[model samples]
Structure formats: C-alpha cells, structure tokens
Target: MSASELVFPPGATRRDWMADGILAVSLSLVVIAVPFVWLGGTQEPDPRVVGVSLAMLLPLTLRRHAPLLMLALVSVAGALHLVLLDVPSPSLIAVPIVAYSVARWVPGHASRSVLVIGTFASLLGPMRWFENTTSGNPSVDVLSWGACLGAVLTPYAIGRRAREVAESRGAEVRIAEERYRLLLAEREQQGRLAEASARAVIARELHDIVAHSLSVMIVQAEGGRAAAARNPDVAAEALDTIAETGREALHEMRRIVGVLRAGPEAGERPTYAPTPTLEDIPELVARTSDRARLVVHGEPGNVPPALALTIYRVVQEALTNFLKHAGASAHATVSLSYGPQHITIDVQDDGEGVEDPTDGGGNGLRGMYERVASMGGSLRAGPRTSSPRFRVLAPLPAPPPSPPPTHRRS
Candidate 1:
C-alpha cells in the first residue's frame, strides 16, 4: 500500500504517483500502436477490434486506487485478447500492467502468490498463442516466456524499494516529533517549579514585614500610655514616633502589595527599591528603645542580596522575641562578628527567661530555623550556662566569588 500511496496524501511521496502515471501511459501507448503493427495482411484494421483493445486499458489509470480489483478485471480482458486475436493485440499489455499493480500495492504474501500464478502463465501463455499461430522455433517460445517474467519482476523490485524508503523516512519524522513533545513538557515543569519558589519567598516576606512592624508599634504604644497621665511632652513625642513608624511600615507594605497586584504573568517586571541590608542594621537599632544595643567587631563586607535579607530577618525576629518575653528592666545585646571566611550573630537578653510552655508557642522560631537552613547556616537558641539569659548563636558561611565576564572582540 505504501508503494501506491499518493505523495501529497498521507505520508506518501510525489515520486511514487509520478512513477505510476508513467507506467499507465506506457501501457496505453503500446495498446494504441498494436493495431497498426498487426494489420499487415488485412486491407485495413477493424474499428471494433481496435476499440476492444483500447477499452481493456481503461482501468490502468485507476490501477493504484484498487490494485487487486483492477488486476482481476484487466486479467480477464487479457485472456480474451490472447484467445480472439490472430495477430499481436494492444490488450495483451494489460497483463503486465495489472501484474505490476498487484506486486506494488498488495501485501507481501498476497503479492508472492500472485507472482507464482503469473509465472505459470508466463510459461503457458506464449504456448497458447504460439500453438494457434505459426509453428515457431523453440528458442522464440523461450524468449517470449522470458519477456513475460522480466516485465513482472522489474516493477515488483522497484515497488519493494519504494516501500522500504517511505517507512524509514516516516520513522525518522515520528522520532523527531516525540523528542519535541518531551522537551516542551520539561520546560512547562520547570516554569511551574519556579513559580512555586517565588510564591514561597513572597509568603516569608509578608510574615516578616507585618510581624516586625507591629511589634515595634506595640512597644511604642505601651510607652506612650504610661507617660500620658504625667508629662504631656513625652507622651506627644511617643505619639509622633508611632505615627512615623506606621508611615514607614505602610510604604514597605505598598511595595509588597505592588508585587502582588502585578500578578505572575505581568509583561513588565515589578521592581522595589531600598531592600533592608547589613548596613540598615544600624538604623534598625537606632529606631528601637535604648535598653537594647547592637555591637559589631569586624567589617561586614558586601554580601549577596538573599543573604543580606536573611541577616536582616534574623536581627528583626530576635529583637521581636526579646520585646515579647524579656522584663521591662532587661537589657539585650546584638553582637555581630564578621570574620574573613564566616559571619556569626549573637543575640543575648538578660531578662526573665521564656515562660512555661502552657501557652501556645509561636511559629517564629520554626520560620527562623528554615531561613537559616536555606542559606546553609546554623542557629542555636537556649539559656546560657552561668547566666539566666537567653542567647541565640548563628554562624553563616561566606558567599563564593563572582564569575568573570567575557569581553567581545571590537
């Protein structure tokens, strides 16, 4: 079937259809010229006889459409042409035309069966014609039989070759299409993972933003309330500080909100500025009440954006914990030791230790642990051996060197 399929149709090639057309035309031409060649002794050719020879070849054009059916019909006509004609007839060419179609379009087992039957005819067909006509030489009989076999096999070999080539090309196309589909699926999976990671980062930011800001505001409110009944100036200053802190928190909240509003599919990437870093820790301590102090021993060099944000979170969360659990008279120290290869943070509060665990514990410690683990760091929080103070010790590794950039030729 592959041999006879149209090249433009399905997976067939144009060359196959063209070859079929050429074979059909060649058979038709031989059928038309047979009458002139055979009318040697007769005065003129009979119109009805020539018409019958041409009529048998009408099925050749549709040979590829239904090869076996066309072969059966044309074969019956060929038998009649050989039996009736005293001279060589055009209808005789139909035998080879139908044989070629059967070999090309029929399945292999069926084609071989047809070929075996045709071989028998190749031997007997010439004897049938030679017996009714002249008493010919024995070698000429052999030659006619050889011609029949050669015609049948030439096109069969060509058809088999065409089928093999088509199947090979079709397999290659299928493999390429399968590879493309797998690559597209892999890209889609990567995109989904990236989106999930971005959302997780955003969730962490939301928690830290709201939690830290609210904790500071609560302490300021409590201080303002205690002084409200006494000195009016001190209470007013606390109110002004609270207002300023609230406004600053609101601005940071807007940045987080803008990112959420843009959505994941936004064309222009949303940008937010002035992210908290190591340098901002000084400003952070200045904003808090004077009972807590931050001390740095070494120069904290430049760091990655993510690590800087992590450092800011560690300080913020530790301060929030001190405010919540420590007594009013307690003092806390936030010490940072920036070494050549590593950085360490020590937050110690000399206040009443964490209360009994009857109250529901918060998720702040768990969040802080996860944050430290993500940056390949370690954190320890517990009471010191000699003192009744709570201490948090964290050690972070230094970031790797940046890769050098390439310079294009001028």
Candidate 2:
C-alpha cells in the first residue's frame, strides 16, 4: 500500500501497543479455557492441542504491525489443527479475529483478499466434519459459521469507513489553510500599493504648494529689492504679499505632514487646512501677473478637498512652467469652467512648447499628467492651433446626501 493511503492516528504510543497485547492475550486465554471447563474435565486435553491453541494466539499480538502475515499464519495453524485432531477446537476461533485485524489495518486489494479468505476459512472449518460423519447437525454448523463471519467482518468494515472519513476531513483542512495563506498574501500586497500611492500623492501636493508659493516669494523679493531704493511704499506692499503667501504655504505644509505622520487608528479629523479650489485662482493669478495673463470663468462653489487641491495644483504648475520656459513678457491664459458633472481647467501659452520635454530633463508636464491621472482625470499638454496648451478635465464624484432635519412640535 502507498504511504498516502495509510494514516497513523495521533497519540498511538508504546503504551497503547502494550495495552492491545494484554487484551489479545486475555481474550485468547478465555477462548481456549472456556470449552475445557464446560466439558467438566472428563476428556484429558492433549499436549499438542494445548500447544496449537497457544500458537494460534501468537499471531494476534502482531496483527496491527503485520496484519496480512499474521492472518496467514493463523489460518495455516487452524487448518493443521483440523487435519491432526479431526475436531474443531476453540483455537480455530482465532482465525476470524486475525482476519478482521488484517482487513482493518491493511489497504486496498490486500484488505479485501484477507476478508474473503478469512470468511472461507471460517465457514469451511466446521464443514470438514460433514465429510467425515454420517450424523452431523447442519443447523449448528451453519449458525457457528455465520457467527464467526460476523465477528470478523463487522469491525473491519467500520474501521475502513472511519479511515476514509478521516482522510477526507484532512484534505478539506489543507485546502482551507492554503486559501487563507493566499488571502493574507494578497492583503499585504494591497497595503504596500496603498502606501506607495499615498506617498506619491503627498509628494505631488508638496511640490505644487511649495514650489508655486516659493516662486511668487522669489519674484516679490526681487521686486521689493529693486523698488526699495526708489519707493518705500512699493517695497512694503511687496513684503506684505510675501508674508501672507508664506504663511498660507506653511499652513498647507503642516496639513500634509500631519496626514503622513498619523497612524491607521487615528479618528477622522481635519488633518490640514481646507484645500484651495477655483475661488482661489483669482488670487493665484494675481500673484504671477507680471509675465502671464490669468483668466477665470465659471460660478465657483465648494468641492471635495482632494478635487479642490488637484485644481489648485494644476493651475499652479501651469503658471510655474510658463514663468520658467516662456519669456518674461509671454502671454498666457488660465481658464476654469465648472459644469454639472465635471470641471475643466485650461492653461495656454504662446511660448514655444517642446515636442519632447524629457530630452531637456524637464518633468513639469510629466508631473502634471501624473497628478491628473491619479484622480481619475485626464490632462493633455501639447501644441494647439497656434500655441501650446495644457488642459485638465476631471469628473466630479456625486455629493453625499444631506442628513434629515430634526423637528419638534410647536
């Protein structure tokens, strides 16, 4: 039998073997001694008879270890006893016990063969008397044969069915464990991906908020220096603008940092200042007006923080690009339109747009594209009818329903 078919139950220790040996020996002794006591000691038992009876039980001790060999040994001993004594003895009963043991422990074809052979040996043992005697009780012989067969086959059949049930349960447990392992692995992968995506988003927001604010600060600083020598009023105004823009930028930075530092168990709270939306575009455009024309159109309202921040960053990045690449006097237009289902923002400049920004080691357009795409939006930046255009279109998610108002009787 293959190792797969054999299942050794847990806690089958040396003590268990000792216990089984004691039980088998006791049962055999009972089978051998009961008949002699019943016959009232009138018939003197032969030494060979006692020796054969004892020998028959030797196989029972090793039944579990070597079932097939033990059954064969017991059968041979029973047949030899029948031929020598010419009478069935209590030792012959051991044949069915050994046969059942073999059938219960052995696997596949070996177990079936043992059961069949054991049944034949049991029934035929008493039948040998019919061939020898002129007056033999057929009813007693049949009953004895039936009882022997039942004793052997019943336990073997129960053990075989139990083994099959145990094997099936083991297989189900293994399959469940495998599925659990796969699910755990998949969850870990998703967590890593989510972490990576959060970091990328934080980086983009920091770049837009800090970079754009710093650019305005630099320009204002330069203007303040140039005007400090001529007009004190102009320099003071420029310095005031710098201070306000710096404070706003710092506030936004704190929010992003707080979100990054917070743990997973942190409750929902305001992590940062509310994100800038379309309404803030007028102020954003006013800051960089010296070199670019900023245009705003559409009735603006409050939007989700994430979408609002996206709009603010898109415009900020577009203006930064114009200032860096286009000449100081280059013309640019910033347009924002809010519709029922989506919001569109377009930044166009008459300056020369590079066919490939990567060749120049510039990531402005690439960053802009990534930012838009992450929000389930689209961004297109290339040459238009006569100038270069960068446009963003983002679908607005449905607004959550308002909670019902509480009422009291007047």
lDDT per residue (tens digit) for residues 2-120 in model 2? 55334332334577578668866886678667777888977766777777787787677666666666677777777777677767667766765665565557767667776777677
Regions of model 1 farther than 4 Å from truth: 1-56, 61-64, 75-114, 131-143, 230-238, 256-272, 286-291, 320-332, 348-374, 378-393, 400-410
Per-model CA lDDT versus the true structure: 0.73, 0.70
Scanning candidate 2 in windows of ten residues, the lowest lDDT window is 353-362
lDDT of 2: 0.70
Clashes of 2: 0
Report the C-alpha lDDT of model 1 over 1-410, residue by residue, as the tens digit. Answer: 45444211242246755766676677666666655666764556666556656556766665666666566666666666656664556566676666766666565566665477567767767777677554677788878889978777777777667766767887999999999999999999999999888777776777676666776777778888999999788788888877877887788888888877775677666668688999888777666666789999887766888888888888877877776677667788999988877788889999986552322266667667878889899999877898778888889887765568899999
Measured against the true structure, the TM-scores of the candidates, in listed sequence, are 0.70, 0.71
* Residue 108 shift from truth in candidate 2, angstroms: 2.8
